[model samples]
Target: MQINGSVALVSGANRGIGRSFVEALLARGAAKVYAGARQPERLADLVDAGKGRLVPLKLDITQPADIAAAAGRCRDVTLLVNNAGINLQAGLIAAHDLAAARAEMETNYFGPLAMCRAFAPILQGNGGGAVINMLSILARVNLPMYGSLSASKAAALSLTQGVRAELATHGTLVVAVMPGAVDTEMERNFPPPKLAPAEAARAALDAVEQGAEEVYPGDMASGMSQGLAADAKAVEKDLAKYLPA
Candidate 1:
């Protein structure tokens, strides 16, 4: 889990927290980083700035073929950051977009799971490399306004735990990073107390280095996690205020 000299691969590295992770990894002296994005052209500037240390990878995490291709090509990777995800503002009830909800589950939960499955052996081969999953506070408690997205993240949390248990034998460190309303395009519509993408990325990389299995990056996520641990029902009731419009 040392960042320096470690080869890393990050999904959705074109923008948002994913892009921040690429920058942080480079700043921390990672030997090389494979920046994965749906459109590799979007990463042209990063590739230029990388000065050969950054390699742009064509990847759409939701596609099994893309996952396979990434695994096949990035064999030297020692760290996998599952940062690709989406939230279409769907809910479980009351005029929510079922299609959008399904998309959330596909991208948020299944994509990461597939990436982990595909790369587990590669990580083991690379001497027990680590995996960092970008989760959210919503993974712990449902926000009725985006209940579908919450459910998807909850599933991802479970997936992270299960992967952690299964990969324990190889010593792969599976880290789950939960942050609230990261200041990225993904959360542009959210309220205050949002964490800067760089800060969140730094926290996640810190967790990877410290061997922390779970990290809550900001005050909002930290408070929500504490509230869930203290009183699950109360947290649910509080989040219910944001029910779907």
Candidate 2:
């Protein structure tokens, strides 16, 4: 499905990669973009920036009522971007926050799953649209800081594949967009040398326009992907060097 002139919905669109997605969609000529966030007020700037191209929708992916209401309201939606997620609260396998881990799963893993389930039918009814899930290369690698995030994204990758197969008949385009540390609020305090959100968003849109099933965006993502395919154990060992001591 071409992004140009499509009715698109992007969750977590208030900041970071989601915000970049909203901008990219407008640039690609999307007819209308329903930008979703936990606090719709946060998207005021986007609405103002888009000058009528962006529509704010209040949504909390973990909430069933929110999902149902969004699905109903955006019934004409043809492009769905699941960009909401959370991070690890403690070190890998740390018992410090089992509850936090569970919460991460709800937002990082089950959140996309829920959106897909709710919007799959709408996309089908609209004559086969595209669904893009923002994932991390951490899905293929484990790091101390990414324990919960890695597990969650790996589950989401599986969900993307499974959903793709199941929704094939519906002509739905399910794509998993894997990228490394984006220069966004998520990584603002981490350090330098991160891919800009604008660049990552552009790469993803390019891949989608080319009908790619999976996309690895940016140098970090591409490098990590290649390393994993060549020797995952070696990559794991090497990635350890970059982790904080």
Q: Which candidate ranks first by lDDT, i.e. highest?
A: 1
TM-score of 1: 0.98
Compared with the true structure, the alpha-carbon lDDT of candidate 1 equals 0.93
Model 2 lDDT tens row, 51-153: 8989999999999999999998999999999998887534555546577668878998889999999999999999998999999898878766667667788
Please, what are the lDDT tens digits per residue for candidate 1 over residues 1-245? 79999999999999999999999999999999999999999999999888899999999998989999999999998999999999888668774347888899899999999999999999999999899999998999899888888999999999999999999999899999999898999889888768999999999999999999999998988998899999999999999899887
Worst 10 residues of 2 by lDDT: 88-97
The C-alpha stretches of model 2 lying farther than 4 A from their native spots are 241-245
TM-score of each: 0.98, 0.95
True lDDT of residue 220, candidate 1: 88
Residue 65 displacement (Å), model 1? 1.3
> Which residue pairs show collisions in model 2?
none
Clashes of 1: 0
